[model samples]
Target chain A: MSEFLGLYPYWVVIFLMMTGFYIVISRGNLIKKVIGLNIFQSSVFLLYISIGKVSGATAPITAEGFEVYGNPLPSVLILTAIVVGVATTSVALALVVRIREAYNTIEEDEIKDEIRTQGAGP
Target chain B: MTPSTDLLTALILTLLVGTAVAVVRMRGLFPALMLMGIFSLLGASWMLVLDAPDVAFTEAAVGAGVSTILGLTALALTARRAKTSSRKPWPALVIVTITGAALVYGMSDAPGVGDPAAPASKYPVPSYVERTDHDIHIPNVVTAVLASYRGFDTLGETVVIFTAGIAVLALIGGVAVSVRNTGPAGGRAGDGQGGDQPDELARGVEPAA
Candidate 1:
């Protein structure tokens, strides 16, 4: 039970990561794939934050009589990661829109089929 | 970790896992997007439980808020339902299982949650936490470390976001312009001899003239 308590968070992280990976690989919809990627990234953020935690620490605010503080480095790093994740999501969605406009379908297989047919000509 | 905090984290993790599975199983794109928002919100809550309020704040704002709106906008521009995949998922399942096993194996070596002696807390982090009072004097060590020590990385991250925004604007903006140009002009031209020309180009049936 103690060991389980110690490592359960990491197990959750792994579960989330694999779920996202499965979605990214199995889904045909471009948007669904993007959503999967977002889940995967968020899980990574959770992993980092989990590592930075200190049991008795509150927020990383330096105050009188407070000895333990969670590591601020991971939080700071993850702030940048969160912004990057947003930017990447927006860019990916924009590309999906453009793909839909060009091919009229966002299905991965259909897009591939269309490309093959177009390349082979009438 | 205290029993209460541990229980809370476990509950949130269970919800997060359930949401992720639901997201993968759902067929409708809109509902999946909503689930994705809920997933982010739950993730933010978990972060809060882990004592990283700053991370929780950003995750709530950016992950749940901005990403969901962007997803809705993209869905409006695309199909509502994901085409059912015909391919066998066994290969993906095998791969995911292997990856999960490897990660689990790796986790055995990782330090427990909030372990003070963990390598992550050893070197520069302690220095940052110790000196924040004397050097930066900011109450929030996160803000001080982010703004003072890692300012360059944050600046680069901002520039990357700016560039991505510009790229999205260029792509989506160009599509909107082409759409508008083709709509009215193609309608007008369709009434004339050149009607077939713009209509064909607008539909991407032919190369633009």
Candidate 2:
């Protein structure tokens, strides 16, 4: 029972990951895909945070009488990662905007259909 | 404290899972974005419970705050409701199931959650704390580690953010100016991001002149 309960965090992370993965592949909407990618990245962040937990510890700060602190390294790395994820999201959204300008639709299928009907020519 | 933290983590994780599922299942792109923000907030709560307050703060701000704003701005430009694509779900489901199962199975040998004795918390562990104290003297070890021990890494992250900003500005700055101000494709002009019902995929700001 401890086994099941203990790693529930990991299970949640995996579930979130798969949900995002499914959305990315199954959904043809480009915006949905970006959101899926967002979920996937956030799950990775959770995984890193989960791995850093120390029993009975406080946040990774040196506080009086607090002997243990969560690992600082993962938190730091994830901080950078979170920022990078934002950057990626913005760039992706910008690209999506550009795509809308190119093709009248953001639906992947419609965009493909537009390409097929339009033909791959200048 | 351990019990309460465990309960809190479990509760938040459950909510996070629900929100993520809702995000994908939600056909309305805007609500899905909000759900994604909720997911980030829930993740932040879990992070706080797990004792990574710095990461929690970043997640709450960057994940929930900035990401949502960006998603909103993007939604403003794109269709609101996601069209039901013709793609078969069975294959994706099978792939995701296999991958998830494999990861969970692989995790069996890994240390249990919050296991302080785990290799991750053990390695050069005290070194960071000790050095941050001696060299940096900052109470917030995360800040010290990020700005000092991992100075180059943070610098790289800044470069990445700067490049992304430039790319976005280059790509979108003109778009804001050039996109024909067609003004509200369908739904009520007051309703942004699908606050009302819609049968057709939102025809957002068309760039066609």
Candidate 3:
């Protein structure tokens, strides 16, 4: 059990990714889908972080006579992922606002019906 | 094989599985969103367990923080319940099941757990440990991998961010112009004085239940 314990990170990541994917694909609400997408993205962040781990490593800072420093690469990559996530959220929010104004309803089915009616020409 | 590590791993795995199930099984958007947030936090912790502080920090900030806010805001503005029925979802179930099976099968070929001689750890870890002075001066091998070997990927990522900002600015500009030009303030000829039937149709008529 102890030996298996070390694999917890990998298992957690897989679970989160699948869960997020399920939500994004199965959910009808745009907002819920976005939430799921965030979850999916976060799981990948976990995977990278796990890969960057060195056993018994301290933080990557130069201290006197310090030899065992943890990896900094995953953190840097995560920073980039964070920025991308923020940008995506902002754009998604803007799109939602536009959707609300254009369709007057955020329900996907309702929007589709409205579009269909418009396309049918009364 | 430490007891503390085993306990922590079990706890984290339980949380991860619970959140993942809740994310898919819960009907309420808010609950699912909240669960998803929990999942992100668990993922961050998992990263920390893996010694990836940077990834954990990003997951904390972006996944658990900004994304949750955005998701909540979007949910507030949108419909709460999805219109679709929460039933079997047979096709998805079948596909996911098959994929899971394949993944499990592939794992059999994977190296034994914690094999220090594994390809990943054998070369890079040793090289990184011994030759931190050359190739990359950075102490962190992960940083070296991202900024050096996969530098192009990092560059592409930066470009993608720039593109997103540009896209948002463009969207804002378009929206602003459409608002100004379509309204009475713009002085455009025949700008919405009639308030046509479509406009009336758009004015908050409750959909049939």
Question: What DockQ does each listed candidate score?
Answer: 0.81, 0.81, 0.37
Using DockQ, rank the candidates from best to worst.
Answer: 2, 1, 3
DockQ, candidate no. 3: 0.37
Per-residue C-alpha lDDT of model 2 across residues A41-121, encoded as one tens digit per residue: 999999998898888787877877988877888898899999999999999999998888778678999888878888962
lDDT tens digits by residue: candidate 1, A1-122? 68865788899898999999999999998999999999999999999999998878888888888888888888998998999989989999999989888888889998889889898412
User: B1-209 in candidate 2: lDDT tens per residue?
Assistant: 46777678778877887898788789888899989888898888888888888888889998999999999989878667788888888999999999999988888777888898999999877788877778997889999988988899999999999999999999878778654443334344436656554422243432221
Q: How displaced is residue A79 in candidate 2, in Å?
A: 0.3
Please give, for residues A12-80, the per-residue lDDT of candidate 3 as tens digits: 566667777777666666766666777777767766665555555565543457666555655666767
Q: How would you encode candidate 1's per-residue C-alpha lDDT over B90-115 as one tens digit per residue? A: 99999999999999988888889988
TM-score of each: 0.89, 0.90, 0.72
What is the descending TM-score order? 2, 1, 3
lDDT of 3 at B164: 77
Off by over 4 Å in 2: A1-5, B180-203, B206-209
Q: Residue B208 CA error for candidate 1 (Å)?
A: 27
Collision count for each candidate, in order: 0, 0, 3
Q: What fraction of native interface contacts is shared by candidate 2?
A: 0.91
Docking class of 1: high
Considering DockQ, which of the candidate structures 2 and 3 is the better prediction for this target?
2
In the predicted model 2, the residue pairs found to clash are: none
